[model samples]
Target: MSFLEKPRVLFYLLLFLIFGVYLSTVSRTVSFGDAGDLITAAFEMGVPHPPGYPLHTILGKLFTALIPIGEIAFRVNLVSSFFGLLTILLIYGIIYKLTKSPLAAFLGGSFLAFSTRNYFLLFCFVYGLALTNHLTIVFLAPAFLFLIIVTIRPSLKRSDLQREAEPKLQAEAKEGRTFPGSLKTFFQELFRIIPPKIIGLGLILFFVGLLPYLYLIPAASHNPLVNWDNPKTWYNAQELSGLKRILTRADYGTGRWTSTTASVIPSGRPAVYQLLFFSEMTFYQFAGLGVVLLLLGIIVLAKKRNWIDLTFLLSVFLIPSAGFMIYTNLSYTDSAALSALERFLIMPYLGAAIFIGWGIKSAADFLKEKLPQFDYRYFAILIFFPIIFHYANVDQSKNYLFYDYGRLMFDSTREVVIKKDDKAVAQPTKA
Candidate 1:
């Protein structure tokens, strides 16, 4: 059978292509902002800014050390590229689970994988690793929860038992015991369906993933040349690595929702303005028709009552975009600030891409049934439209915008310093 018939083969092929593209376009050197600090810290085995991101520091350092062919920054950037590819692979698995059709999953995965937005966001993990990132990934929690639950649900029992049991459970829920009692019972049932092995494996993997964070204590002690916040002592390291600093981002500025830092947009503009700004950014990224397809996909998923998939998509999108709008104090007037905040919307945009795939598939199937003469493959032509457009915008081959910008900034600073020195020399000595 063709690879398409056996989805795993198709997934690997697509993953190879994704990795190749990112590898070719990976940054050659540190660009700006936190990147300089990240690469330096990783290379020197030093602690980074607040939250320390020991995990990222460890991986980046490993990549830098092992990859002898490139600049330190380039090697570190490869870490993001690696995780980015893995995220795309996970997305493909997610879509395949939601829709058994390999073609649909392939299209969904490829659309997001090739898109310009993911090129920067690098899945939600990149956000966590890219210390300068955002809380957008928080929104994906519910989605992941739903995905895990659904995946395990089928393996728990036969289809007949599940269908019959759900109704009885729903009736009990409707009769309503004390809220806490009901909640406890709900979880008890959920736990029963999930295998103990699955639970143990998940816990083990999570903690193992977190082992990288332990690298912070040693890195902090080494007193690296470029250490930020100077987490040298046990007490200071504890404070910086504490929940308060990591969650509230106390290292940079106020961690509160109201705190207006470089990342936060001003609180002056109305909510509608921010909505428009976000909509405009998304439109340009996904294109107009792509947006429509996403909405249609939501409707299609909803009508079919694919609650697990539907809820996951909604949580991923709404929690970041809609919920963030209410809490974030971003201003509508500061175009630069608004534009900067647009990156946080990447997670929601990812949900839109998945929906777009579903919508296209739904439409193709409907048309095929209604109009027997038309080939379903022709409908796939629509999928290529977004890919073509996104590739055109994100084609990074030989792109040196960041390099040029960094050079200009460095030159400007040097000139300013020189001018200051010249003035100091020229001035008459004071009494």
Candidate 2:
């Protein structure tokens, strides 16, 4: 078999290639936005902003302590690169599983790895670093669901089963079976289709994932320097309320759907503007060719009657894009807020990249039929387009703006003093 047929080899090759690119561009010091705060929080085992990312804090602490290569901030930045790479690999794996075309997977994965937004802020200390950007990570949910359903019920065609059972159900009804009996039979079939153990295991693992949130309580109780919302009290009259506020992001005024007072979306702008902005961002991510492939991929899936995979891609893409746009209602004019909003598009772009892979597979299959002499593997060269186009813009190896600014701020502040609400002042100290 050709090397393209060996997915394991291709997987490692992709990993190596992307790792080199990421390492070359990763920030050597603290980045903008929450980088300084997150690095400090992780280093001191403290908390950052609202929803105090306990899992990221814990993991960042481990990365900072274990990786002795760079400054403390650089180690934390590396954490983002690590997860960004994993996210790319997951997209590659998902595409390969869907298309069974290694070339297609490579192109899709590389497209995402080289995208400008991903490299600049994604692999940096901003939202994409340390999985604090839940929007990007949430896209994995549909991918996981798709894999689980495909693996567990690959041969269990729901339509065929329904058709086969319908006649039996009618016969049973004619024979005077009661409504309750039919309902019981229906549940039995449902349980048979999805075993109880699998459901129980899924629920158990979900709750286990919640275990990390408990870390916030103790971390806050220590009165860490970066603690937000101070969710330390758990047993008093305010039991868990503070923690609940942090977790629910009450400080940011999230969770309400129609909260006009809390919405950041400008008043004159309609909800449809969010959808338009998302489309514009989509076009920016992949450019013309990539977007074409994405559309073609959707068409190919629909033509092939592949509802499951199609739905999976659509869910991941639309939910984070259109769904979030409508939900968050963030204003488009605010550059800072918009910049933050753009990071959330990483997951949607992942979905689009997978579709691009499917489109490539479809195109290659057509080409093979039309021209037998043509080698489809040459299509993999397309991966270099983004790499070449984005290299100059995305490279962050020498980017030290954030690092220098942080140092300057610290050095400029001589004899710093702290005063509490009670007017208690700590002794001044020289910088």
Candidate 3:
């Protein structure tokens, strides 16, 4: 169907277009953090530092060559924006599926995908792939798992009980208390209720999604401008790919905590410290009211028995926010890295934003029923709030920091090299 036929489709397009334009305007030139290495690798068709981002590099190379707009960096930046938009689209689809209200879904999805802000995935394909575009994707696993369990747990238990009681029921068949169905029919019914087939398919798709890692092998062999820990051989490739890194994550001196380490109170700090920290991040992402609305949304979903969506959002929220906080043992000494971890909290922010949308919808529905004459369209104005909040916080359209920063770095390095060269020239005769 044409987009106009579906309000959700139109709203998705509108959100994507607006965000795409904004991201393009703020697109960096030289690079930001790992972005510089990523751009260079992509431009030269080389591998990036450690477990190279094969998919990002390959796709970036194609965009740099073919996009026919702006400089190489700008083109790569556009690729980021493009994917950013796609992520927004995905968020909208997910929210719409839950809320079944176009307006609510739009606001919620926009808040998560664009408003809160956010990654590249292929080094060590599992982690890299998971983190390639956005590390928040990892939150999906917990969310999906929660949804699966919540949706099927009761059914599974019921099926098990029925199976166990089947013999008794069959024995009583002579007394006319027969089993509900024949053995064949019972097996068929049990199969229908079982979630393994669907879960198995999901697992297959998840692995298939990692196929982009295959590109790394070929890209590594070519040896481009910036190949870190060059993965020319299979052994080197695996090493660079982060297989060891994942296993030896503890060796990196990173204070990563997991569910197992949940008991060890870091620095003798109480769990309340983590809760407050989580609260602060959530408050920052969505104001105090938004957090309340998120809780309210959970209540609303529970009331409606929306187990699937509730579990999904809980997964997204808990995995990244609570899960990370439990496992990632950050210290007060490193305010910088801890601040960066705040960025990872975007998953919970996303989950909260979604519930905020639902909360808005539920409130509006209730109010409209109470006051039948009141125009519910007034609630539409709240949509502009998220848009305005996002634009105000994120707008860097006129910032030329990337350019100035790159030039400064280049000049400083050149001067150092020149000084070293002069010192060598003066001393070389004696040698």
Candidate 4:
């Protein structure tokens, strides 16, 4: 196929199928809880402290003002669904950039877009706004990935740094004598790694510098997650504490004990482990097997000294997943109940995928060189299997999947609008 001719047709065909499912699943007749509240909060300009998202509220208001639909519910969710597509596209672009292979990129975007959690949330539910969380994850994942690629992609050479550092050296050359001793060493190393003139005149953008902001974006300072300043609601902290205690525990006694199936408390997170350390959280929890693959992948990336695998390790180890491990193992009672481990780390999922893709591709390429015409198409299929599996699991009648933010908007005005008269009434002056 020359990696060029007609693959995008397949890519977009997949996207259309996803969109079609989303369109068919919207529940026009029945409205639900939080989805309606988001719409309501939009017109009213705010929402209850602990769980509200101001940026999301502002977006909801803008949609309602323009659409003028009787039910703002489906409309609001549709917006996040659109961003979900944007997330998919961005991943597609980045994966293309990382692999220089169109098929790999398509597979990467497909995996992310159809990730069971991502798919169910983006396509199946009224909680269109809820998809924003993963959209946030997918979106910044690329920006962070871009940052990584930009920082290291072309592999900066020492000669290039010397040329860029020209002006400062010119000053030293002109003087033909000792500049300040402290300044001499500084510029020497500066000239060694970066061009002196460019270092002074322009900013050197690096991965370590800009990435912290992704984590900070979700913190929402000034408009803190809760009104911590007010003492009357002080016990809101305690309420969060109590709620965590109740829901996080695993009671095998709960759920169906007899229905042809059994559920366990899941003392471990297999996927988190598998994706990070080479051990599946549960299914492939064998000793030493995963560790060897983990080391082999690490050695491949390390031999090349590439940051892709390192970033994947960080995402797997440090970035918080929307799963039970964070609630149970990484608990910090005072923080947002579900958001304790670090949603800020969410910025790196794309980078994680990129590095993992590169790591796998690079390893396979090296082995193929030794194996005499080893075909790697099967490797591609296996890597993409996760995406296919996720789509199947997440395609549960689309309506059941999302968290329903429109339900928040639907009732915002009724729940919050003030009923005061238009004209101002005069009050007596105090002596």
Candidate 5:
């Protein structure tokens, strides 16, 4: 029996129920910041030519047309909610495909659904920030997905890249014919136990995975997650120069030293003298874990020497993180990487999660060889972190506001319309 069929249905039904309840009772708190702006842009413009978010604004406006855009709160929040669910499902699909661990996938999905990061954005985060959450989930999930695809192929032997292994690994590659030496084994592991002869459908989903990154276009107009433009909040992207440039840009038209520090701290030196630019975003510890896994996977790859695991690790984790590091040096605020590049690079996270889960499974397997006490129960404990984080996130769902607790964040009066700030205008357009 397929475990996914039942669990996914249950999850979907629960998501619908919870979302319906949230909208019905607490819908009053539904938000509109950046996403509303995108929707507004969509109504004003069409495909390929929306103001900022060509992806979200167009999509959100189209959807809202079917529903009611009358309420800024509900419409915007719902759009993100829909994509958020898609992300959860996508994660499951990747885990199932990559790790072949349905239990791990279920646990991973539960953890993501209840994470504090997601919770704060969905419930309490401000408008634009909350909408960014959609991007985070959308692109991140797919990035992980494609990374899995790319890495999975290499895990098989060279001949398997085109043909099937002797047997099917997952249900998909059931019809492969195996021949040759190491080549036969490689074909079996990537797409299926046998080789997956089909391509169109998988290819579509793989490319479809990248669509969420479009929101970054309009997102740049503002400081994104942190108020980097606010001198106080610069370096939110983990670049010292980024903070300096952001405030410098904010000081447009007025060259006041207070507004723009220019040479305030000298090049090659930090303005604030901190260890790193961002907090809560960098995945130093986790990345380290991935590095460790890569070294180990390389050893396992000796006989198999699967480039997929190695590529998955290097490309997903190292590449993106390295990109952020480079941005820190070259110093372009417009192009400056997110401080949370490590987090946003969800491919790495997926790999890490897979490897970590696998490590748990492997350890359990090894211990089982020695002692009977070690079993899936040990892995169950390993799965609890994300689950607890997710649930804790949901409990405080209503209080989180997408952005900060400023008047712009929650203007209950409705009289204080935001026109002075283009970003303020952009907030509700796509939400």
Candidate 6:
């Protein structure tokens, strides 16, 4: 077998290649948006804005201390790069596991890594980790649940059937003279189906995951430089209101919905226009080819009667894209609002990438059967189509516009203060 046939080898190859890409393109210093504030919060171990991303802040602090690289801002940016790489690897692993094809996984993972949007696609991963954008990550819950159910369904069914048979066996034993081992056999099957050890380990890990949130309490208590909504303050004698405020995003009025409950398009627009706006955004994702592949993938799954996989993929896509669109109720003409909405598309775009992989595999299989001598792996070159189109748009290497602008403002302010001090000294203390 060729080296590429080994999934482990291919996984490492992807890791190195994508890491290089990320390192080249990652922001050197603070970029726009919450990056400046986030870097300060990470440096000071303080809480950021609403829904204080305790986990992100904690991880960022570790990166900032440990990296010893360029500026502290760059180290914090590396946290985003690291999580983005992990997200890409997860996509690769999921696709490869489902398709059993390295080519498909490569295509799926690369499509997502290189897809162009307002910000890099991985901004969702970064924002989801460090900022208030939780819905992008939250949308994956349904897909994860579906996967868990599908994995254990067969064993669960067998367990249920065995339990039903136990009553009949007991009834038969009551009628008969003997059947001594039925109870022992039933208890053994119960343990086999749902092992206590596994359940205990799962519960332990779940709680461990929640441990990151505890960082908020102590960090907030210090009341560091960039603390937003000091979560250490008490609401009553018993409860910490500031902590509750940060967690619930009470200051932002998070739970309140607007009157305009329509599709992803602006509420005032016609349905046709709204759909056209939505469709245009979708079309540009992978260009026309990606849409075709997405449709083909759906068709392939439907034809194979793979309802579980189909539902999982569709839920991952729709819940983040359509669900968020409705939840946000954003305007098409509002550039800032639309840009914010665009970052949420990463999760859905990931789902589309997987579908594109399936489509690629299906097409490659058809071509191989017709021309037995042809190397279908060459079709992997199609991954570059996205890279070529999106490279110019997403490339951030040497793009220090935000960083330079910030520095220039800081320097100008310092110069002005220095000149004023010099002028005062020149006046001889007003004598």
Top candidate by lDDT: 2
lDDT of 4 at 65: 74
Cα-lDDT of candidate 6: 0.72
lDDT per residue (tens digit) for residues 269-338 in model 1: 6576667766776677675777777788999999998888788887877677766765675764566555
lDDT of each: 0.65, 0.75, 0.59, 0.44, 0.42, 0.72
Taking all chains together, each candidate's TM-score versus the true structure is: 0.74, 0.80, 0.73, 0.47, 0.49, 0.79
For 1-431, candidate 4 gives per-residue lDDT tens digits of 64332457646755785577545543432233344444444545433222234456566567667876645655555555666676666766765665565655555555444443343233213233332332223433543565666675344555655455556667766777445743775567657556677665545454443343232223323232222112222223533322122122111122211112322225566455424422232112212222233344456667777765455554543344333243234323324422322222223343444444454556557667998688655454543455444444544344432335434533554444443321111122222
**Overall local distance difference test of candidate 5:** 0.42
| Cα lDDT of model 5 by residue, 1-431, tens digit | 54333546535643664455334333233333333334334444322111133455545555557776444444545555566556656666665565566655555554444444343234212222223422223323434676656656555565744444333433234434333433545543544633475555777786775464334334444443322233333345544323344333432332321112122223665422222432223333332332343344344444356665555554554434333334333222322223233234433344444444344334445667898864554444434454433453344334435433444554653555443433223232212
**Model 3 clash pairs?**
51-123, 51-240, 119-133, 120-132, 121-132, 121-133, 124-241, 257-327
How do the candidates rank by TM-score, highest first? 2, 6, 1, 3, 5, 4
Per-candidate alpha-carbon RMSD to the true structure = 7.7, 5.3, 8.0, 12.8, 13.8, 7.8
Candidate 6 per-residue C-alpha lDDT over 27-49 given as tens digits, one digit per residue, 9 for 90 to 100: 77777666777777889999887
**What's the lDDT for residue 279 in model 5?**
24
Clashes of each: 4, 0, 8, 33, 43, 0
- For 1-431, candidate 2 gives per-residue lDDT tens digits of 88876788889889999989988888888777667677878898886776678777887899988998988877888878888888888988999998998889988898888886786443335445433435345545766687778776844676745766677678779989857667767776666777889878989998888898888888988887777767776423443336767777665666543234433765766577888887787777775678888999999999999888888789878876777777678776777557667667766777889899999999999999999999988887887888887887878778888778756755666557343321111133353
Give the lDDT ranking, best first: 2, 6, 1, 3, 4, 5
Q: Model 2: which residue pairs collide?
A: none
Error of 2 at 128 (Å): 4.3
Q: Any runs in candidate 1 off by more than 4 Å, and if so which?
A: 1-6, 121-125, 128-136, 141-209, 236-248, 257-259, 262-269, 332-336, 379-383, 397-431
Candidate closest to the true structure, highest TM-score: 2
Model 2's C-alpha root-mean-square deviation from the true structure amounts to: 5.3
